[model samples]
Structure formats: C-alpha cells, structure tokens
Target: MKEAENIFLNLINQHKGIIHKISKMYMKDAEEQRDLFQEIVLQLWKAYPTFKGNSKFTTWMYRVCLNTALIYFKKDNRKVDKAPLDENIDIMDVNENEGKEEKLAYLYTAVQELNAIEKALIFLFLENQSHRDIAENLGISEVNARVKLNRTKEKLQFIIKKNGYEF
Candidate 1:
C-alpha cells in the first residue's frame, strides 16, 4: 500500500497539469473545475494498475484525463449553453501575442461545441499526437484518424466563425 501510494503521488505530481488543463477547458465555474480535478485524480488512481507503460507516461496520462473528463461530462449530462452573442462578445477576443489563457479560451469554446468523439480527436490533436498514435490510442484506423482530424479542424473553424472570431 505504501509503495502504491508513493507511485500514485509521483504520478499525480508529474501529470497534474494535464488535469488542470482539462478541468479548465471543460468546466466554467470554480466549483465544477475543482470537482472535475478531483474526479480525474480519483479515476487515475483507480486505473493505475492497468497502466502497462507501453506508452510514455504523459501520453497515457492524457488518455486517462481525456477519458475521465469525457465520461464525467456524459454521466452528469452537464450541458454548457453558449453564451448569448451580445451579452459578452469580447469574451472570445484572442490575441496571438498573448499567452495561452486567451488562446486556450478560444480553443475551449471551439472544443465545447464538438461532439464527444470529435472532442477526443481534437484533444489528442492539440496535444501533438501523431495520427498513428492517435489511432492506437483511440482504437481507430490511421486513415480514419487523419480523416476525422481534418473534419474536426473544419468544424472548429466553423465554430470560431460563428462566434465572430477570425481564428
């Protein structure tokens, strides 16, 4: 138990940023973000032993984090309504010179509009996973991964345009 706890703690310390990033991307409110973070941690701990180290730890961690967030969103049926257009048009203002927060917000809005499979695809794409790796991780064909990624990018572009953003 002590050994397992140590391993889990180490894994958490190493991969915690993924949890934070996913939570921030998916959850709008502070309370929901905290809940999602905790849930990701719990799910990671639960799935630890099955981790065979066949992939990089961070790669495996991304899979687990994405899976947990996707499942949580599904199970809770928590739908995020797109904010009314005039209510806060400036919220989507993205500055290329700025840091990740602004860019991430735009990406998050685009991501939120995607369906679950597309969300997973975009998540892996943004993480810089190759089509082959994404296919292995997602259990799909490499051709399918490539095709879906292209379509997902187009969908994201459409979402950005619909939201009045030029990106």
Candidate 2:
C-alpha cells in the first residue's frame, strides 16, 4: 500500500502541470480553478487503483483530468463571474514583457468564451498532441478531431479578433 501510494504521488508530482492546465482551461476564477484541481486530484486518487497500465501514466492522467473537467459543470451550475481583463492570472507561462503577457491573457479570455468541448480540443491541440491522441482522448475519430480542431482554431481566432486583438 505504501509503495502504491508513493508511486501515485510521484506520478502526480511529475504531471501536476496537466492538472493545472486543465483546471485553468476549464475554470475561470482562481477559486474555481483550485476547487476543480482538488476535485481532479481526488478523482484520480479514486481511480488510481483501477489503472491497468495499458496506457502511459500521462495519458491516463489526461483521461481522468479531462473527464473531471467535463463533468464539473454538471455538479455546479452557478454562473461564476470571470475576473477582469486587466488583471491576468498566471495560469500559463507568460512572457516577461507586459505586452506579451497581456496578449496571452487576451488569448485565454478568448478561450474562455469557447464551449466546453471546444476548450478541451484546443487545450489538447496546444499540448501538441497528435490527431490520433487527441481523438483517442476525446473519444472521437481522428478525422473528426482534425476537423473540429481547425474549426475551433478559426473560432478562437475570430473571438480574439472580435476582442480587438490583432494577433
């Protein structure tokens, strides 16, 4: 039991960024993000014993993390208010320059406008996951994943432009 616990801790520690990224992608506010992160961790812990080693640990973690994010809204329907545009949260790696930081924040703001599935697809795409991997994670055909990814990117671009961002 102790050894299993240690392995799980190590795995989570190594891939904690997935939790942060998925939580940030799904939840807007800091508090909701924290709550969702904890929820994902708890779900992962509960599902850890059932892990059969058929996939990479990170793959399994993605499944668990994305599942939690997908269902999180079903449990809570309150319209959580988003933070203002000027105060950008450090959800992802930001540039040292103020201009780049604000641009990334604007990108995130555009992302927040996306639907739940669109957000997941974009997040996986940004992670550089192959189309097959994205499809597998998303339980869709690779062609469908490709189509959606392209459409999602166009939609995101439109959203960003509508927000008055040139790039």
Candidate 3:
C-alpha cells in the first residue's frame, strides 16, 4: 500500500498540470476551479488501481480528467458578471507583445465562451494533438474530428470578434 501510494504521488506530481489545465478550461471561478481540480484528483486516485499499461499515462489521465469535467455540475446555476472587455485587445496580434501569462489569460477568456464539446476540441487542439489522437480521445470519426475542429476554430474566432477582440 505504501509503495502504491508513493507511486501515485510521484505520478501525480509529474502530471499535475493536466489537472490544472482541464480545470481552467472548464471553470471560470477560482474557487470552482479548485474544487473541480480536487474532484478530478480524487477520481484519478480511485481509477488508478484499474488502469492497465496499454495506454500512456497522460492519455489515460486526459480521459479521466476530461470525463470528470464533462459531467461536473455546479450546485448553483447563477450567472456571474464578467469583467469588461478591453476594446483594443487583439488576441492574435497581442500575444506577440504580451507575456506568456497575459497570452494565456486572453486565450482562457476566449475559450470560456465555448460550449462543452467545443471547449474539449480547443483543449485538445491547444495541446497539439493529432486529428487521429483527438478523434480517438473524443470517440469520433477522424473526418468528423477534422470538420468539427475547423468549424470550432471559426466559431472561436467569431466569438473573439463578437467580444471586441480580433483574432
């Protein structure tokens, strides 16, 4: 048991960023993100024992984390006010001048406007997953994945423009 615990801790420490990224994409509020992160960690630990070595650990982790995020529901459905958008912000051009943090913040804000499946597509795309891998992960046909991804990108660009930021 101690050996298993140490192994889990080591694996988690190495791959914890996956959890953080999923939580960030799925949640807007800091407190909610933290809670979701914890829930994902717990789910990962529970599912760890059943994991086989057939797939890469990170791939398996993505499946678990994404599943958790997809099904997670907030207790309250109340909407929170979003911060006012800056009229001059351009996501595509701004990233070149901004620091990584600012670029990431801008990306996340843009992503928050996406629906759940679109969010999943963008998350996988941002990670540079191949269409095959994304389709496998998402359980869709590769052609469908390609089509959806193209459309999702266009939609995201449209959303950014609608929000006064040009991509």
Candidate 4:
C-alpha cells in the first residue's frame, strides 16, 4: 500500500503541470481552481487502481481530470466573477514577459466564455495534441475533433475580439 501511494505521489508531482493547466482552463478563480485541482487528484487516486497501464499515464490523467472538471462544473453550477489574476495561480511562464502575461490573461478570460467541451478542445489544441489524440481523449471521432477544434478556435477568437481585445 505504501509503495503504491509513493508511486502515485511521484507520478502526480511529475505531471502536476497537466493538472494545473486543466484546473485553470476550467476555473477562473484561483481558489476555485485549487478546489478543482484537489478534486481531480482525489478522483485520480480513486481511479488509479483501474489503470491497467495499457495507455500512457497522462492519457488516463487527462480523461479523469477533464471528466472531473465537467462534472464538477455541472454539480456546482459555478459562475466566476471577473477578478484580477491571483499571484497564487501558477501562470508564471519562463518567458516572463509582462505583455505575454497580459495576453495570456485575456486569453484565459476569453476561454471562460467557452462551453466545457469547447474549452477542452482549445486546451487540447494548445497542448499540441493531434486530432486523433484529442478524439481519443474526448471519445469522439478524429474528424469530429478536427471540425470541433476549428470551430472552437473561431468562436474563441470571436469571444476575445468581442471583449475588446485584439489578437
């Protein structure tokens, strides 16, 4: 049991960036993001035993985290008020350019306007996942992933532009 726990903790620490990204993509508030993050970890732990290692850990992680976020959002019906970026969010990039940070902030804000599946599409796209991978993760067809991703990008751009921010 201890060995399993240790391995799980190590894997989580190694791939925590994935969790951070998923939580932030789903939630706008720092506190809410943290809560969602915890919930994802809990879900992951519970489902860990079912991992048969037939696929990459990350693939499994993404499915669990995304499902958790979608369900969490529905269960809570959360509506986040537009608040300034919290210093606590792990948004600090290696580039550290203020302009880039501001741009990213606007992007995140615009992303909040997206539906859950749309947000997942954008998130997977930004992560450089191919349509096939996105489809596999989302349990959809590859062609559907590509079509939805293209449409989601168009919608996200419209949302940002509508919010008075230029690309």
Candidate 5:
C-alpha cells in the first residue's frame, strides 16, 4: 500500500503540468479552474486502481482529464456577468514574451467559444498528438478525428478573426 501510494504521488507530481493545462483549457475563471483541478485529481485518485499498464500513464491520464473536463460544468449557478476584455488573461506558458503572450491570450480567449469536444480536439492537436493517438483518446476513427480537427481549426480561426484579430 505504501509503495503504491508513493508511486502514485510521484507519477502525479511528474505530470502535474498536464493537469494544470487541462484545467486551464476547460475552465476560464481562476476559482473555477482551481475547483476543476481538484475534481480531476480526485477522479484520478478514484480511478487509479483501474490503470492496467497497457498504455502510457499520460495516454490514460489524457482520457481521464478530458472526460472530467467534459463533465465538470459548474453546479447550476450560472454567471450573468462577463469580465471585461482588459482583465488579466492566463497564458498557457508563463515564459513567453509580450508579443507571443498577447497572441496566445487571444487564442485562449477564442478557444472558450469552442464546444467541449472541439476544445479537446484542439488541445490534443496542440499537444502534438498524432491523428491516430487523438482518435484513440477521443474514441473515434482516425479519419473522423482528422476531419473533425480540420473543421475545428477552421471554426477556431473564424472565431478568432470574428473577434477582430487576423489569423
């Protein structure tokens, strides 16, 4: 039991960045992001016993994290107020320069307009996952994954451009 606990902790610590990115990609607000992050960790802990070593830890983790994100919507207290555009936006990378930061900020902002599955596709694609890997993670055919990804990219571009920034 002790060895299992230690192994789990070490694995989670090593991959904590992936969890943070998933939480951030799914939740826009800082507080909500934190809540979702905890929820994901809890879910992972609950499901950890089922991880048979058939796949890489990250491949398994991606399925769990993305599923949690898809189902982790707020518990019914919908917000009617919107934050102003000038409010601080969290970039995926902290070390990027101002120019790239601004671009990434806008990109993240545009990403919020995407549907949950679309967001997952874009997130995985950005992670450089192959089409087959994405298909496996998404539980879809490889051709379907490619088609959906291409369409999602077009839609994301349209959303970004509609928000007045050139692609």
Candidate 6:
C-alpha cells in the first residue's frame, strides 16, 4: 500500500497538469472542474495496481484522465446546458506574446465545439503522440486516427473562422 501510494504520488505530481487541462476542457464551471479532477485522481488510484508501465507514465495518465473526463461528461450530459462562454473563458491577444495559459484557453474553447471522440483525438495530437501511439492508446486503427485527426483539425479551423478568431 505504501509503495502504491508513493508511485501514485509521483505520477500525480508529474502529470497533474494533464488532469487540470482535461478538466478545463470538459468542465466550464470551477466546481465541476474540481469535481472532475478529484474523480480522475480517484480513478487513477483505483487503477494504479494494474498499471503495467509498458508505456510512458504520462501517456498512461493521459488515457486515464481523458477516459474519466469523457465518461463523466457523458454521464452528466451537461455540456449543452453550460454557458457557451463563461467568465473563465480566457481569450488571448495574438498580437501580444502568447503564453501557456492563453494557448490553453484558446485550445479549450476550440475543443469545446468538438464531439467527444474528436476532443480526445485533438488532446492526443496536442500531446505530440504519434499516430500509431494515438491509435494504440485509443484502440482505433492508425488510418482511422489519422483520418479523424485531419477531420478534427478542419472542423476546428472552420469553428475558429466561424467565431472570427485567427489561430
């Protein structure tokens, strides 16, 4: 139990940002985001024993966090009810220096328009995982992953244009 706790702590410390990122992507409200983050951590702890360490820890963390967030979002079905633009929405002025927070906010808003699966694809893509890795992680064919990614990108582009925002 001690060993498992240690490993979980290390993993959480290293990949906590991924949890924050996914939660922000899926949940607009602060309370919801906090709830989702706690849920992800709990799920990760529950599944910790089964982790085989075959893949990078961050990759594994991403899979777990994404799955948890997606499942939670599906169960609640509250995305449609949430405000399209909330005070938490962070818009970046591209004219000035772009920081991580600004990029993350823009990315989150763009991803909010995507379907669940598309959002997962875009998340992995942004993580710089190879198509093969994404396919394996997502349990889809490499060809399908590539196809979906391209389509998602196009959709995002269309969305940005429709919103009158330049990427």
Q: Write model 2 residue lDDT over 103-122, tens digit each, in one string.
A: 76786777888777878887
Candidate 1 structure quality by residue, lDDT tens digits, 45-153: 8998988988887878888888888898888897744332221122233445766676777778677777666777776776678999888777799998888777777
lDDT of 1 at 29: 76
TM-score of each: 0.80, 0.85, 0.84, 0.86, 0.83, 0.83
How many backbone clashes are present in model 2? 0
Q: Which stretches of candidate 1 lie over 4 Å from their true place?
A: 78-96
lDDT digits (tens) for residues 27-132 of candidate 6 = 7779998999999999999878878988778878888888898799899975532223212222233335557567556667777877777778777877778999
Best by TM-score: 4
Report the error of model 3 at residue 140, Å.
Answer: 1.0
Instruction: Mark the regions of model 6 whose C-alpha exceeds 4 Å error after superposition.
Output: 78-100
Cα-lDDT of candidate 1: 0.76
Please, what are the lDDT tens digits per residue for candidate 5 over residues 78-144? Answer: 3322322221222234245767877777877777777778788888988889999999999999998
- In candidate 1 the C-alpha lDDT for residue 156 amounts to 70
Please report the TM-score between candidate 2 and the true structure. 0.85
Model 4 RMSD, rounded to 1 decimal: 7.0
Those runs of model 2 whose alpha carbons end farther than 4 Å from true positions after fitting are 78-100
RMSD of 5: 6.6
What local lDDT score does residue 83 receive in model 2, on the 0 to 100 scale? 27
- The TM-score, computed over Cα atoms with residue i paired to residue i, of candidate 5 is 0.83
lDDT for 61 in candidate 4 is: 89
Cα-based RMSD of the predictions, in order? 5.9, 6.4, 5.5, 7.0, 6.6, 6.0
Best candidate (score: lDDT)? 4
